[model samples]
Target: MTTDTDTALEVTPDAAAAEFDRQVRTLLALGYPALSGRSPEQFAALVAPLRAEAVARAGSAAYPAGPAGPETAPAVTGRVPFVLVVGRALAPVERTMPLTTLHGGRLPGFVDRSFEPGSLERFLATEEARPPGRDGVHLLCEVERGEEFCGVVPGDAMATVAERGRTPLTLEEGIALLTLFPEILVKNKCFSLGGSRCGDRRVPALWISKRAPKLGWCWEGNPHTWLGMASAGARHA
Candidate 1:
């Protein structure tokens, strides 16, 4: 007596793996869409006609940044585990490796549907509020081969985002938002969250991006951040 609903909900290892891969690709694509996260075939699809053009440019690359400033200390590049609460969904973006995400769509080969409009700005605003004190965010980055290290997020790095036109989130506005009540920003994700038992704690695994490469936020490298998000719901005032 097999029902269609049971067949649809059956836990298939392959399907779960695919879901995880999608999320990982989304994270990496959002973080460093310029490079990384692709197979040779996928890369070919993205560049096909322009592949050689890009290679010609890469081979002629120069040490343009010259030298690092006190600002760019800790040198390597990295990004924090981000949580983007969009409309009725949560888009988690991270600067890390994409596990099993396979090809197609712009550069870095992410599932394009993963992103939502204007979410990047909101994410940037959050990061600017409590930046990684000179030491850098919790990201374990590997920018220079054999010279891997955690990268610094300059106090004014948010300004760089604006200069590059990555996001419209102005550094000025981010600083201002920090002092206000957290509820104003709106955590619809949490409000919409439901939970299940994973032992003692009720894990809000659903909070992870729909594109995530794994089942839970603990896989995000910053599980503790969820605590802050949860507690913020009830203001001490």
Candidate 2:
């Protein structure tokens, strides 16, 4: 398993702060306000309090073990307490912005043409995906790329996650993770956002294609050697 947490780099309070700031700037530069319907100041205000604790919380939490095995967990380098998530309001362009912005115009992120907005809307978060905290824009805690579940069938991965008392990443959460840490979406080791699902077998996933990131779907029962399931430990304000 790859074991690359949020990003391939070690997480320190300083790194966390830098990354967090970068996300804000990136979102604004990319005109996130247009999609999110929140002003830059509003977004800035939401994260101001978090800045105060960045130093205290950074590199403090233990990295949880991956579902495949304990060894698949990354060493305890450091942890960013929260990941700023913009939610599902920008579902139509979530995947594209991250890829285009992060990749430096190499290749734009691709969304399957079949997933028209109406069809994409059907893939709601599973019951397990709901967090006890405010469900709108918020911070996600203990996020992981779920590398241990690589090569595991999406259906089996979901069952394993349930048995382990954890939640899989929703489509929005998955996009948020990638938008903040593009390095996690490397070739031959992509991930599925199994927390969001349609009535049938399709599982939303993010993968690399032509050296670019792609938002697509995979059958629940099929196992792909390149894809693992992404997950988060919890969500909060």
Candidate 3:
């Protein structure tokens, strides 16, 4: 009886924004160019529109109620499946940093605070949730990230957003989520970086990327990292 619907959560535009901001800041601090600019305010202004677009896309999707029936849909049993959709306008430049290179040799507390609680940690806990073989699709919304700019997920994929508490996302929270889940670090890929705004209103070009696997790092093969991001998103859901 388990279904995607049972695992899916409704998210709002505001909540998406908050998670995006949190993720972006985390990447910047971790030596990732997820967010490169002057001032927190400027960065916030740059990413807002992308977040809004993501929220809209998530809202419009017809996500599964839980695990689909054997004949009705693919069985997404075992660990709950979810997706983390990111939207940016620029691609990340090639760069590798030792653990010591991280600001203070570790992920800052602020970055931790931004994580969607148990999203990443929990998602990586199970083999079924790991990328490349996982059943779900993680979408990315990049303006110029790579060959798959704009939409990262296929048309047949099921999609939904993870909500925090009862409110939608704010810019800060969204960025924090990205920081906790840097798996979006695909090579030759970048997210949107610039946009227009009027007065206090800002327009972010929006970059998008999905959480996938690479061939490096201490925990590169483990699922812990992916689970961490998923767990965080679930908490918000």
- Write down the RMSD of all candidates, one decimal each: 20.8, 6.1, 17.3
**Alpha-carbon TM-score of each model against the true structure:** 0.19, 0.77, 0.30
Instruction: Give me the runs in candidate 3 sitting further than 4 Å from their true place.
Output: 1-6, 31-39, 61-93, 96-237
Rank order by TM-score, top first?
2, 3, 1
Q: lDDT score, residue 219, model 3?
A: 22
- Mind giving the per-residue lDDT tens digits that candidate 3 earns over 1-237? 123334533334554445455545554565433334336565445444455455665443222233442122212222211223222222211122121121112332122222244332222212211222122112232111122222332111111221221111212222322334333332343221111111221212112222222211112122221221112122111
Between 2 and 3, whose TM-score is larger? 2
Model 2, runs deviating above 4 Å: 1-18, 47-56, 62-81, 90-105, 131-135
Candidate 1 lDDT over residue span 1-237, tens digit each? 111221112223333233223323443444322333445345324323322222222222111121331111111111111111111112123222122221111122122333345433343323222222231111111111100111212212223333433321222221111111121122222110111112222222222234332222222123332221211110000
- lDDT of candidate model 1 versus the reference: 0.22
The 10 consecutive residues of candidate 2 with the worst lDDT sum are 68-77
TM-score of 3: 0.30
In candidate 2, which residue pairs clash?
Answer: 59-78
What Cα-based lDDT does every candidate model obtain? 0.22, 0.66, 0.28
Q: Candidate 3: lDDT of 56?
A: 60
Q: lDDT of model 1 at residue 6?
A: 17
User: What does candidate 3 score in Cα RMSD to the true structure?
Assistant: 17.3
On lDDT, the stronger of 1 and 2 is: 2
Instruction: State the displacement of the C-alpha of residue 120, model 3, in Å, after optimal TM-score superposition.
Output: 27
Expressed as tens digits, the lDDT of each residue in 1-237 for candidate 2 is 223453333346665566567666766776666665568797677555555454455664443333322122232222223566766754344433444423343676777765767877788889989644443565677776776777898999988888878788887777777676565677666889888888998999988876677889999999999898877767665
Q: RMSD of candidate 1 to the true fold?
A: 20.8
